[model samples]
Target: MNKFHGIFKQLFELQLPGTEALDLYEGYYAQLYEALTSRDNYDIPIVMEQARITGGPVLELASGTARIVKHIANAGYSVTGVDISDDMLAIARKKTEMLPQRIKKNITLHKGNMIDFQVDEQFALVILTATSISLLKDEEEVECMFNNIYEHVKDGGRFVFDLLDDESFENSSLRMGGIDAITLNQSPIPKQFILMGEQRDANHSKRALMNFYSEVIAEDRTYRFFGSTEKTYFQYDAILPIIKKTGFKIIQIEKKELAKNEMIYMFVLEK
Candidate 1:
């Protein structure tokens, strides 16, 4: 397993309406989300490539901190980002404020859910990046998102997303302890992010009851974060049936390796 792998993306909250981290740390969690996502930008470049295909508007689900949204807009694409977390949207809005007026005007942030969002017009490209889809409660939510994404996608447009493949899930036991559990610390500022997580069997074998207890020590301040959720774990062969049932038709699927034992399944689908 990648040592810092867990630390980098571990802060991903289950979904919108925010999490206990916000209540405990107030604006602190949003800042951390920006810091972590800004540091790696796990999949922004690939998402931008998709944005380039259609010179039309783009919509991104779970667009936390508007990290991807800002990048796309800076590239001269109009982007509408929808996310549920107020803390995150606030940061996204704040960050865009400093951009050149032209770029700033190209980005829009909406406070909403990925499962059911309303927009008058459809987009030429729809994206769900950063493996945020994994936070969906179950296959049903996944379908709900797909169905909604289908509605938003224009004819001949595409849907692109990546999932952390289940290849490494069998080793969850090795990561269940605490922040003491994983470390990929290379930050210049002394940082302390403790993720207290455990993986346990859910109602279904491919789902896990995830418990989160996190604490963060910033460069000069200390904060605590917390949350609990039951999230779907994906295995390609096992979930293929679910995807096949969606309105989208898979056009291409590929795998990208980030670190040892860490692989992401990137899927491109057409409406």
Candidate 2:
């Protein structure tokens, strides 16, 4: 496995330590869904289309926290949500366990890396949304990852993903400078969260150094945790070639405006 897959594999390896490190991820994952679903729906109609095409089972890659999975299941489709986060999966399991029997009967949660996860049966559609594809760090791995998705999807099945636009990628990289912080209201205990991103490459492409920090205030003690992740973005101009190299024909590229004056693109593909 490559470094990207390796990181996810380590994140999902079944163990308590795996769960502990993932606690932070679980918090963010839930917060993300709460924030997104509260305003604009994220791919609800697209997912509903997939549900209709399959007539039943849908496979979701990098399905963090089962937010979308629960929605898919509630819509009457059987869903298998796969993610490489034991911490996230632990919370997913608990949430699913608490569901009514009807919903619980149609959902399955698994610990698997996105690049290598497989099941005995082929799916009608496979989806990677919310820039989950961005998690893979570079081009070679991106190619490998797409190939894996193509391999797993059925002959007539469709693959879908959402990402930033190429033009936007260029525009942002040129004037990249920002420091924005977010605070999540839902926490196990009182906490303050801050994410500061510094733009590095300002020409050709978009690249940013994302620094994440969280301050937790327990009853008597205060703790701080910090980590950094680098995001290197691509334009649609640069990305289509890579998608074609893996035999994925881009069926549609839809763009929509977000509340924050950002345009998002969704790429729909088929084998």
Candidate 3:
């Protein structure tokens, strides 16, 4: 029976929804996303700390699952989270339902594209963390996003975000592999996942193809595999001009080492 159940599970996960342009995190995958990322994303507290220093109403673009937005709201800032994924927004709303009234009242989630979103009021602090700015497919898209971010910020307000440094990606291996575990609702039945991937430069563009295969193993030792391929392009020199053209003045750009083999670039911009 366990063998049969595993087979069914594999088939289900194999059919999970995704597109060349976007990955749809719904149903079982939604649960998996929550399980994988519910922990303190070090970026959350970092952004929250900045928000406290800068003051708010704050805005977070591509705010997946409200992980960071929730922290800002709970820290007593009014925050708005915007994303294009209904599945992600659904999970965020469900989680918000359990928050205290004060915190719940402080957070607002909107379904919109980051390149073209509008709000009634401007914010003192705007952020896009966790390398989400890489999701824009090209320079034109990045310009549009920066323009929107510019319009959303109050004069002298700060815009904060993180991205992969060009040197890190240029020096990275073409292929890599890793393993991680996802514990569902703190249940003992942990799901082990593996990632194996390669990166290749895209033709005539600074963008590159990030292709990967992922396998998730169930408690019964049954497993499923999912594949993803996306375009990512962000270089400090390439992006800085766009930010300046969109009316942002660079305040600081710093490199932080997270691990022996991993590093990130943080940007602070002012309008």
Tens digit of per-residue lDDT, candidate 3, span 1-271 = 1111222234444565431112435444555566667774657656766787789899999887888888898989999999887888998999998999999999999998988988888999999976777777888988988888888899889999888775675325432322223333344336544343434443434454443233444555544444343546477788878887898998877777654344678888988
Model 2 weakest lDDT span, ten residues long: 1-10
Per-structure clash totals for the candidates: 1, 2, 0
lDDT of 1 by residue, 155-175 (tens): 988898888777665345433
- Model 1 misplaced regions, further than 4 Å: 1-27, 169-193, 209-223, 259-261
Question: Cα lDDT of model 2 overall?
Answer: 0.67
Q: Which window of 10 residues has the lowest lDDT sum in candidate 1?
A: 16-25
lDDT for model 3 comes to 0.70
What would the per-residue lDDT of candidate 2 be over residues 1-271, giving only the tens digit for each residue? Answer: 1211222333334332212222334555444444434344557677677667656677898887777788888888888999987777777788789999899898998898887777777777888886777666667767887888888778877887878664664436533555567775454655555544444544424554444444555576654444345556666676789998999888888887655556668887887
Model 3 regions lying over 4 Å from their true place:
1-27, 169-171, 174-192, 202-205, 211-225
